[model samples]
Target: MDVSKDTPQAPATAAVPDDTPPEVSRRLRLITLVATFGGLLFGYDTGVINGALPYMTDDLGLTPVTEGMVTSSLLLGAALGAVTGGRLSDARGRRRTILTLAVLFFVGALGCTLAPTTAVMVVARFVLGLAVGGASVTVPVYLAEVSPAERRGALVTRNELMIVTGQLLAFTSNAIIAQVGGESGGVWRWMLVVATLPAVVLWFGMLVMPESPRWLASQSRFNDALEVLRQVRSRQRAEAELSEVSALAVKDEQEKLGGWQDIRSTPWVRRLMFVGFGIAVVQQITGVNTIMYYGTQILTDAGFAADSALTANIANGVISVLATFVGIWLLGRVKRRPMLMAGQAGTTVALLLIGVFSLVLPSGDGRAYAVLAMTVTFLAFQQGAISPVTWLMLSEIFPMRMRGFGMGVAAVVLWLTNFVIGLVFPSLVSGIGISSTFFLFVVAGVFSLTFVKLYVPETKGRTLESLEAELRARFS
Candidate 1:
């Protein structure tokens, strides 16, 4: 059920009740950094392709269809990776799963860097997709489980910040590499290789980090849960939080709630899954990836020369990172549902303008600048509102026992939506021209707004366990 803004409620605060020791505070910050390198990899690997693809096209002899294939293959692999990664984290543990994914990140990057054939490149990208998909699910879930209830939104959303930071890093790296090697061949390979360093850092970092206390508690290891919690939280608060989490963990195991059968059989789980799937689909249908994955091409179509388009594309990455900073601030001050509605509305208008600018303006600087303005405006709303909320809400809403699996399934839906959009966007522009293609996104934005207004629930300012109980009562 949607919570009304006027409803009586306590004031919002991100402060944990217990005072944190300086060492614990530093440890918490360090953990956030290390864990978010997974997010960094997620950003760099996905965003690097945006700049590298043009060069790769020439090097690999890609046609339009093959170009789409190369781009979409990683997304296709992500679709598979989402479910598999989620399940692995659920059965094993969050830290363990992330450590394994870091290795995948390394291997996948190396494979893509060295591939001599399009077939091999496609295969390597798919392998990288696995790491990307796994990181998306595991990193946020780990952060959510480890955070204080009051700070969960801010802490968990750090992954989203790192994601865009990685993207910016990719954009910056791509620009530098392109410029430095303007006369040389295979610069995209250098772009692809930058991702490997972070993968190595994430692997070494995860080796020293503590596992999720909630996951350990869910396994009936109460003592271990407290120990893990203490690594991030103050001793008194860690103990207090563990008591509440332990009670839920016991009830969860008693109920044995997990997987497809559990989700189908339980009323609230089914409803949450429905909501989760809708959230995932809503995010993708906005066509944000078109900008993230193919921003250079989008700018080129807007009229800039190829080299100029690559440099102009950096604006998109910069706005995404800055807007995410605003989003992290907003997540603390504003309610989530309204932020989502506002974002959708902003993006819809931006899309409408993009179509208008394309259809009415003649090919030249004016048209290009107008569309560029709209794309930047569109991403400000998207990264600030929609993307962060989508990921944070999915991380928040699932039952503790099945958080990994539930989010995995929703992420599958997200990635599949992303895959279809990535696969068809080139054809979409080819068949309909730029104006009509954006108009289609405008229509999608309308529906996405309606869905959120009526069905999406508020998840702000609550612990995951409390949120789950509230949802169970309402859905049941």
Candidate 2:
């Protein structure tokens, strides 16, 4: 339980040295800020439903079954989007795929905003989900490929920070809008429309950003790759890194290592895929999204009125954002596997407490506050540890040639898990009630912790190329 005890020291390549020119550093920061808008959109679209769904349910006359469909259609679409987006980013380019995803974000949000029927809204959310799933896979891979190994964890996790920030924005906006328009008939539409603005920002921001240098190298565009790398890395370091990247790119090409066949035929890759799938599943089964997509409803169910629940849910959003900031800093300091294990343990305990408080406490402010307290504590660990490590490790562990595809396929499992949880969570709460539903998650979390302890590798100190080599050797 002492996370620091027996932890391995970060290697020589663990931190970014103060050798890069300021301009190059600025460029890297700029790219990270722009690229992570995809994460921002992902966060907003998903989190908006927490508050919007209540209003939407009233307006659309949604039964629990239809509500689940509306809420989970995006997740189902995301399952498809993750794989398709991964393949698209690998085939067309990360920047282009994001551009395309941005378009989808805009169109989908608008569709939801103007949706006249339940079917239309579900379809629109499904479209929005495609963009979300695509962004989930592509953005991290792009950031991972562009970042220096030393800064990779921090830079790539900025996307997660953006994601939580977007969620906060959604939570905050939902509260304000509900307060102002609580009497209005179609207030949820306002909440849905706010997402389109960020989609615009993501599109324009990515237009000026550079493509992933590693992607360029994969296509044998070594000179183009070097130029892009030079924008973020020092002149000499960029050249040296380009050589390492290109050599791997060529080796992967010659070995024909980037397709479904490669994953099946190659023993090491097959093992790597197993680990990747486990990592993806572990992240979703934590029951984080249950809180995310239904925190307001849960609060209302506990004791708060509709308006108060909307406001209180912002606390969850705030905690998530703050925890993610802590998580980003921690990734720089600790090993990934231990951090993840710590998060899993923290969340499981919090969930158990929530179930207990719900079962034992009477229906009033005490039970509500206790449940809220546990949810906040849960977010602190979930965002700060489980999420950042999951995405960063996924972005880090895959082979360079198929980083997009591998992460994408893994994300399919992730989104599908999310989809099932989102869909059935309502029914579970309606059927088994929240306490037993969360107790179920507690059981799942124990399994998740065991998986991380057994299968997840430490990925903090090594470059992507070096890590891939290490994995290839260890698995082989």
Listed in order, each prediction's TM-score against the native is 0.97, 0.97
lDDT of each: 0.90, 0.92
Query: All predictions: root-mean-square deviation over Cα?
Result: 1.8, 2.5
Question: What are the runs in model 1 whose C-alpha is more than 4 Å off?
Answer: 1-16
Query: lDDT, candidate 1, residue 189?
Result: 97
Candidate 2 Cα errors over 4 Å, as ranges: 1-18
Per-residue lDDT tens digits for candidate 1, residues 1-476, read 55333222332223347798999989988998999999999999989999999999999999999998999899988888888999999899999999999999999999999999999999999999998998899899999998887778888999999999999999889989999999477899999999999999999999999999999999998999999889988878888788878888988898889798898889889988989998999999999999999999989999998888889889998999999999999999998899999999999999999999999999999998898999999999999999999999999999999999999999999999999999999999999998999999999999999889878888887777777777776778
> Model 1: which residue pairs collide?
none
Model 2 lDDT vs. the true structure?
0.92
- The most accurate candidate by lDDT is 2
Error of 1 at 75 (Å): 0.6
